[model samples]
Target: MPVNWRLKLKGFGPFDTQLDWSMSAGSAKVAIYAGNGQGKSTISRLFRLVENPQIPFPSSLITTGSAKGKFSFTVGNGSADLGHVEVDSSTGVDNQLDYLFHVFNSDYVRDNLQSRSYSPSGDIEGYIVGKSNIDLSNERQSLEDVKRKGIDARSALSKELEESKQELVSLGASRVKEFQEINVDFLMNKTVKEDCYADKIEQLKAVDELPDDAQAPDKLHLDDSYLDLDQLASLLERPYSKANFAEAFLEKVRRDAEFIEAGMRIQDGDRCPFCGRRYDEESRLLISQYDSYLKDQEATVIAALKGKQAQLSRLIDDYGRLEAQMLRGSSSYGEMRRGFDDLAKVEFPVLATTADFTTVVNAVIDEIATKNEDITLCVSSEAVGRLRDALGTCQSQLRDANKLIDELAFNLGKSKSRKTTLRKDACAELGKRIRREHREAFEEIASLRSKYRLLEEELKNKEAQSKRSKKDAVARLMANLLKGVFGNRYTFSEADFSICFKGETLGKSADSVLSDGEKAALAFCFYVASTWELINEEEDKNKLFFVIDDPISSMDFNYVYSIMQVIKNLQDTFELSRTRVLLLTHNVAFFNMVMGTKTLNEAWMLDEGKVTEVKNELLAPYAAHLRAINQVANGAAPSHTTGNSIRQILETLMHFEDPSLGTLGDYLESDYGGRLNEVAYLHLICNDQSHGTRTFGYAQPPMDDSTIRRACNAVIEHIRDRYPGQLVTAGVEPSENNSSS
Candidate 1:
């Protein structure tokens, strides 16, 4: 059972800010002193809200520019762990403190007692029990089925949502990591990767035309044409035929190829260079052979063909080196594949292989040797055309290589753009993959959410139908409310839920005849009676708590004491090991009475958003009022109630001499008063400002606090000079050398 409570109130009524304005109550008799306009009623509403949170927010509590109007209430046996009752403008209300809170204020009276045409719905404390007598077991079973289905659907929907979220999360992370691994500077981090992808996607629209040449970045010469076969064909077309040439000599020359080559250089003129004989046949044969060798057209053609062969060999070597340079490493190849393969979606063309290129080169070399060996052999047009055909194959291969290099250059030229495009391509691939892989989970979550909503609606309809027979709480509540009362002063007729005043059923007539004090007292009895209902139902009475806010409003001295006695009787009747009462009032006499003997000495003051517990002081209300005025005389700040205190003090003194002298102007006209001319208008401003709900300070274009303080101070001093002895009766001790003369 919860035995104690504490509340934090702010941004409502007099609090006017989002501050943790706190108070500890209910373990003992907590008395808080707050004058009118100091948020007394707002604090009461905080407790009332706990008993019933469904009540519409009272618009009157909101200030013009205050914090998000919110309330938080808690209950415990003075421990760090506590249960909470929360309400805010946003969440409406969640009353977790249970029904431990009860309040008595003008609202309680107006809601319960004054509005005599009460029905079962208006019973805030219907604290109702006992269900319908009629049997609707089938309808209840149907509602139970919906409740179960709702629970299961909600659980399944939650699971599906979690799974879908995980799938997306895994996909996003995998894509982010893959883009980072592409080893590009722009895709260094996750945010950069995503932003680069999205930005380039937009940028890619501007560059809608594809890369200028779509081929591999590595350029390799793969055709025999790149071997410069045109020059080889031209060398093959040369003539080296001689009709008088000797066959045997030619055979010898062929056999002695090295000797003939040397003889040709030595035989510079006519003399037989080898044997030193002139015009001899043998020497001439040697000289003629040398001369024939030097002028041999076939030999000259062989020399040109050999030169072309060397040039082709060197060209082939350059092509091989270039092929090796472009397609060098696995890392570079993989990067290229990732960028172009995924984005272009076109199959990458394979370049002509090294073995194929080597085969073609060897064939062209053999053909060159054939032409060189038989220089006088007329080159066949068929042979030239075949060579040209092979060269054409080589030309096609070279075209492929150049196209690949051009394509590679085009993409690499915009590598920043390429990187962006690559990132975008990677992102897009993931989108398709995600849609393909997790489509079921996404669809299932959405389907379950709709099913859950429908089940909840079904449950509501079933519940309403199941409650076809409900027992009215009115008769039971009226019986309980009439248990404890102030004699036959007022009896509530249960039929119409109206108060029977002396055999006449008072409808709205309760307001016509009864004074505010009588109504307050009558409302308090009903409030007490509701607690009797609580005491009967509750096994542990200590769990119940009551907050009485200004219960003795406008009550005379006799009814004030009667109200106090009634509250004490309630405490005795509670029969708990301990009883807690938090009596908050702006009424001075009631505060003094509740605080008990002057030696009791424990009192709390709430002023200007702060609370102070002043112990070990005489708890006299009028004396405190006078002391506040005296403190202002000695340069202390005045309180909001300073004007009310001044008015009371003056009213008490002026009426002491003449009961009819209600105002300062009336007092001034009397014989014992000062001249009537000066300061008469102070009556209009000072007298009416401290009074009631339309307290002039709150109603009119308000005077600042200081302006009201000065006015109240002036009146206190003016009266204190003439009636110092009367001030003593209220409790300002006379000074030894006081200037009362």
Candidate 2:
């Protein structure tokens, strides 16, 4: 069990002065007596705050004149401080103090019974138990793994497909079908070697054919009939001289007289235009000789020879020009030029000016013509053969190159188509597999999630069932405690699953039917019973400390005795040596009763803003009220304070027995039969004399002390005659000689 060995309070609540409470080892119980609002409940609430650090600290806990407060305590046998609560600018406590103590006070009673009708749905203890045991880690982890694996597998497959598609694009497949259909055999096989055929095709295209006009002429025929053959022979046979040609021409013209005269006129006559001089016999004779010579056939032949020689020179010049203009690379033109050069190197017969020279020149011309004809025939025939051979070679090479290119293009087309087809097929297969795997993974995840959800539902159902069972058990215990406290005057039952008194549930009609004392008794019984159930179910009973505050409030003397017995039974049930119990109350009579039993390890009285240990002494407000009453009856001055004490004593008695007479005025007027001045009683006691807010002035003309003393005596005599068994004196037991009416 967790026990507070030492507790210190500084600037906290009504305890403005520092206070220390140290519990000795093996001490099981401590009883603290304090009047209303004297910090008895504050101590109980502080223990609760220590047990649950998450609860907000009470603002009222700060001392009246201080801004900050602190509470410190050491738990169990260890001297180390287990927790501390500080209230200053902010309020906080150590979280390590959770679940160490349990407290039952008026708040517990109100929450369980009086605040609302008690019902099974409102049973909080079972809910606490259910929430503590819920586990779903393994199922969630399995679902996550399934999802992760599926995602990873799909991602890997998609990456592979994307890479394969990129590879196909690099291979020059423009469309899907092109790369999809490609196979290894199609790639390896080549219709034509690219290095061998591609260049050959280009070379064949570069070889161009020559035009028809560029070819050599088919025939060589010379028109030498226009040539001066005799002159040509003469020039070839004789030494070439312009002067000898003129002398020969003159000798030929001397035979004709007319020609002679013409010649004489050319030599000596100035009178004639044709001849330069007059015609003499010698000149006539010379003319006659030239005339005869002119008539000769040899002269005419010489003229013809000269003409043939001029024609031959012109032909040679024309042939030289033709050769210069011929295309250089033409095979036909080349052959023709070579033939012409060979013909020019051959020699021909020389022509003479004699009559026979004509025939000789004619024969030379004929020979030259024949040789030219032969050269023409040979060049034309050879050129035809060479040109034909070249054309054939060019056409054959072009045809072969074109055939190789066509084969290569066909093979390339097939390769692309095959690759496209293969790519499409492979991608389709991969996509199908990926989809199938994704579906399978999705189905698996769905199945796992379904099972996980069902398990969650099962857990919720079991928790609800457990809560119902625990609530039923608590209800039975509460009903039994209620019966024990109320006796046979009331019967308990469950109506709408709520606690009912005498067949009526609380807050329905029980309030009107039962008195305030009965209601307080019911609340007390319920709190004690619930606490008993909780402590019995606790795993570590030693760690629990029970702090009960004012359990007997609004309860009659009969219930007070019963409640004390219940507390004693509880202490005995759970060995007090193991569990620590702190009971705080403002009821002096009850406090004295418990103190007289000698069952408590220690007892302390809270009065005049201080807590001090007390033994065998009555504590105020009970002691104070009793002493003041005795003093007044013994001739002491009856002041306003004494008047208030007289009223307080009467109020306490009326509340304890006849709770309907809740105030001193109500008891005085109703039970005393108007004999007591109720107005004077209120004026002397209940009026706010310190603040002076009455309709009259602050000095209300002090009532005659004798009159107040007489009133006090009348009330005391009424108590002694009506209920003499009740104790009214401090430090004195009730008289057994007095009897109830």
Candidate 3:
């Protein structure tokens, strides 16, 4: 389906202008023109409205005070008769203006286009992108079936289990009649005796709670305070004042003896001088003085004794206190010792005292010593109770066993019932799988058909694209065909256009790898391939026009010119100009290269929002002036010679800092071709002019040309050999020989 849209705007700011356009049926490329911000892209968005109608019109386009304005477009078959949509106010409502909106829908599209439905394209996306819808429907159904069956199986199993449990409960009560006379009394007595031993063991544990020696308050007090009289005495003798007293007494005795001597001498022996008659009156006086002296000395001795006694008294008092403390301490120690002895007496033997707990135990035991004929009472009540407990435990075990049996029976029954249900479920699942698989198979067939159609469509478009590309590439190749092989300095015509190469074939066609400028020619062949494919697809006479926008931006000047020449050749050879050849550029040199006196039909300069025509006379004068100025300037300097025979002229001109005519000429030629060609021309000219010089500098100096060539050639040869038959070629070597062009 093809669609056409026309838009008019009044208050839309930059997009206020009106434009009328149509996307001729089957055409995908749309060329837009204008400087930055001129609304060139706005027109492209209007076409998208048919594909998606939700985008609101810009507010700028709305009339003042008018909430909205209408946006209308026609979509349908090849003609504009399909329908038109007028959107105003609310954005999404589709208002059929005068024409009905045309929608080309097949039954498949209708049934599969809804959200709940799955189209082949959507299904394919699901398959590849992993939101698969095919098995989801079936899986949901099977899950529901399985859940229902599981519930039913559980219910059946539970019912069977309940029944079995009830039966076991009844049977357990009936088994109680067999063991009625089991002795329980003896068992209880034995238990009580065991309990007594346990209590005794508990009592024995009390010894651990007895006060330790170090912690006993009384004992500690005794140790701290106790002392005997002997100890008191020893304690008191530390200074030995008694011996000192005795020594003092002896000294006093000696002093008394001295006094006696003095008295006897005064009384009995003759005193000299004034005492010559000492026998009479002085005898009594001497005796009296001696007596008084003795008495005073004795008093002194007694006083010394009394002082000694006082000292002894203090020591004795201290001793008494010490003795009292020692006795108190001893008493405390004794009390602690007694307590400890008593505690020691509380030792418990490791084993029980009675060898057999029976003798002492039997006394406590209530025996069941009874006998009867008809119903034998063999065991006591205690034994009977024990037997009853054991029976109860056994009954519990039997109950558990019965419960397990019930569960097993229930499970078996449920399993049997589930087998039938599983079969039915399996049948249902199989049916679902069949239906789903059938639908899928049908869908797969439909998808394959749709894919084949889509691929066919794509192949046609791709082929046309490839063909156009090849045609452009080939035309460029043909125009620059001669430049690839012959020297640029020499003149050559189309008749002399020959391309030859000495290198190995690089897998591409001859035009492709023939030279550094021939790969585009080979690629051009594929463009033709594409054209053929497109031609085979549509028999309609409609054709496409290509408008290149800065296509040669990456190409050097020479290449750009060569591409223009190719464009011209294509226009002439294929009659492509009848449709259109809108080559846009900002480069003056490029404009000159393509637009000549008669080569181009018309020249348009874009200004404001309109196209203005330019004349050849205007372009011609610019070229003429540039050429004349370049020539006279060349003559004034050295000649543009390729021979080294002109070196003296170069060196002389270079001697002063004035520009050499050779360098000036080279710089001028760069405007025509590019720096790459300029350098090549310079190198060749330099080589020729310096032919006899020892070193041309441009040449390989004294080194082996073969060695450098060999190293380069060897690498190339090695690469070719390593890849077996692989070879590579360049199209246009850039100024740095980067080969982008």
* Residue-by-residue lDDT tens digits, candidate 1, 594-700: 66732112366665565556453225565556666655544556565666666665666687878876566677667745532354544554455575444445556
Highest lDDT against the true fold, candidate: 1
Question: Cα lDDT for residue 511, model 3?
Answer: 30
TM-score of each: 0.45, 0.42, 0.25
Cα deviation at 714, candidate 2, in Å, is 21
Top TM-score hit: 1
Off by over 4 Å in 3: 1-503, 507-536, 539-541, 549-565, 569-578, 586-600, 607-610, 615-618, 621-741
lDDT comparison, 1 vs 3, better candidate: 1
Model 2 earns a TM-score of: 0.42
**400: Cα error in model 1, Å:** 2.2
User: In order, how many clashes per candidate?
Assistant: 2, 55, 32
Measured with C-alpha atoms, the lDDT of residue 124 in candidate 3 is 14
lDDT of each: 0.57, 0.52, 0.34
| Residue-pair clash count for candidate 1 | 2
Lowest summed lDDT window (length 10), candidate 3 = 119-128
lDDT of 2 by residue, 401-493 (tens): 334334333433344343344345444443343334344443544455566567667656655543434455556666677667777676556
Per-residue lDDT of 44 in model 3 = 27
Instruction: Encode model 3's per-residue lDDT on 1-741: one tens digit a residue.
Output: 443433333222243333333333332222232332333233223322333354554554444555444445443446656455544434643645332111111221223222222111111110011123232444445545555554554454335434433422332311222111111211111211111222222222222222333232221111212222223222222222121234454465444655554555555444533356546566666455545544553333333333333443343344345344434544433332222222223221111122222232222122211211111222233432332343344345434433433433343334433333333333323233333433433344344445555655654444444333323333343435444423342222223222234432222133333333333322232222122222211221124333344434345556666556555554444434233333455444556556552334445443223333454412332322222222222332222221331233223324343454456344324432233232333334444435644344545444333322322232233323333222221100123344454
